[model samples]
Target: MERSKTVRKGTAYWILGVFAIIWAVITLYPFIVTIFSSLKTNDEILGSMLNLPRDPVWHNYYVAITGAKTLHTIMNSIFLAVCSTAGVLLFGSMLAYVISRKKHKYNKIIFTIFLTGIVLPIYATLVPMMKMISKIDILQPNAFYTLILIYIAICLPEGLFIMAGYMRGISRELDEAAIIDGCNTPQLFFRILLPISKPALATSAIITFLACYNEMIFALLFITDKAKYTVSIGLLYFVGKKTTDMGPMFAAIILTTLPMLVFYMLFQEKIQSGLTAGAVKG
Candidate 1:
């Protein structure tokens, strides 16, 4: 009977594994097709949707990179993502630390306010955001960074949520010890807590960076100049009212997605650690 039970368990495990594999392939099928399609000619792609490339058109990459101004768009995305992530990490973590450590009415009020952002759809604020920005005359197509504050504002509340949850799991004894060591508030936050909270910070950084990188609606509404476009906006190069260019478009998409794919592959362990940080109390 025990042997029969063990065999049943093994069979169940095999079935689950097979299901997982099928799910993975199903999800990854589109990306695989996109990668292969990018290596085909426009006619070949339309002609042979599922067939492997007979003669790979590697020049599609060069065309996408040069013709679409991929470098400038990628650079813009990188700069915006990096700066926005930095701000989110520093400000969000500190705010979380303060709110978690102090049990006060105003802190609760602040925390509640930040929580509201998670429920709020950004589209609801678009009209108001535009109206408010229009009143300020500093906006320019070249000065796209005038949108940095908006990015930070959109990012901060979510970052604060992750950080505040993580920070709560941290013991007050550490803060007391830091105080005992003659550490000031800034020193305690910057020197000790920040390093210890790396998992949460990394999680927030990656999420915030992805959001800032892939954001299109804001970029579209705020920016009009092709020279100042992000990779998301750069996607328009292959699209037209009448027809869409397939090969170069797919190539650009693959190129655009590569950075994110590489980033996740590199830091996957850190991200996993951060995600499972609260599973066990240290």
Candidate 2:
């Protein structure tokens, strides 16, 4: 009987291994092609997509970084993403803490509103938002602050939801202890609650930052100035009215994608732990 069980388990492992290999190839093949194509000339790329390059052009990277708007766009993306993530973390956590801890009559109503935000599609509101912003004059020409505000609004719902769920798991006894020790609301939050909620906060931060980093449609619609464009928008500039520069475009693509890949690799373990820790308790 034991031998039969062992054979079944081995068969299961083999099946899973085959599936894993196929999945990896499906995901990684495009990235491999992009990297290899970036190292070839436009003529070589046009001649044959599958053939190896006759001579690898390492100058693509140099031109992408120095000759194009790659560096400026990268900085813009990082700045917007960082600022928006910070805003979401700060205001979202505060709102969650209040809703979770307070026993006011309106707490349930406020929670319902936040939950509604999660269900609503952002694209549905874009036209109304554009009209309102245009009327308010805040959507002035070349303003990045407008984009930042939009990011904060879009990210707040998920940030608050995650934080509220995490806060539910924290002990109420800790709040009572802090109150007895004469700690004010800010002190209780910053010193005690925020410190304890690091895992959940990190998870929210990563998600918010990535969202802002990759946002394209709104950036394309709202931003017109070349100087204010993010990496996502800047990449589209590689395609001209007449022709597309495939080599430098791929090089730019690789550069834009590498940072996010590195970031995910660094925080992937922590994100998994955060998700499981908040969900499961002894």
Candidate 3:
């Protein structure tokens, strides 16, 4: 009976291992195609996507970076993502801390209001928001600030949910200890709580950054200047009315995807732990 059970367990392991390999191949196939396409001529891509490049067209990358201004747009995306993420983390964490720790009659109501923002479709408000942006003199000069504020608002609800859960898990005695040490509320938050909430903050930051980085519709609507275009907007340069530069476009996509792929690979562990810890503690 023991030998039979052992054989069954080994068979199950082999089946799972085979499934895992198949899934990995399915997930990675598109990326492999993109990389191969980037190195091929337009004719080569149209001829056969799976076939290796006849002679790698290294110039495609050069055209993508210079002709399409890929690097400049990537920089624009980075700036927007970093600034918006910072604002979301600051405001979201403050609100989360208050609602989670403070004794207040209206805490639940306030949280529900923010939660409503999550459920409400962003498309429903786009027309009104566009009109509002046009009327505001401050936003007329630069769309970056406008985009940052919008990202912060959109990301805040989810950030609050994650942070509040994590904060609730923390012992209230820490707050008392800080108070006894003559630390003010700001000090307690900045010095004690924020440091302890690194995992939750990291999770929120990653999500907010990626959202702002990849967001195209709002960027396309708000930004008119070519110089201010984000990576999503920049990718459109390869598409022309007459003929699309498929090779250069594929190269541009590869360049754009590399940074985000590297980022997620680095922080994937933190993301999992943060969600797990927050869920358990809350």
Candidates in order have lDDT scores of: 0.82, 0.84, 0.87
TM-score for each predicted model, relative to the true structure? 0.88, 0.90, 0.90
Tens-place lDDT digits, model 2, residues 92-180? 99998998887889989988887788777788988887787778875774588898888998888888878888898999999999999
Candidate 1 lDDT (Cα, 0 to 1): 0.82
- For lDDT, the strongest prediction is 3
Q: What order do you get sorting by lDDT, best first? A: 3, 2, 1
Runs in model 2 with CA error above 4 Å?
Answer: 139-141, 238-244, 271-282
What TM-score would you give candidate 3 relative to the actual structure? Answer: 0.90
- lDDT score of residue 40 within candidate 1: 92
Please give, for residues 169-246, the per-residue lDDT of candidate 3 as tens digits.
999999999999999999999999999998789888877788889998788888889889899888865556334568
Query: Cα-based RMSD of the predictions, in order?
Result: 3.4, 3.2, 2.8
Residue pairs whose backbone atoms clash in candidate 2? none
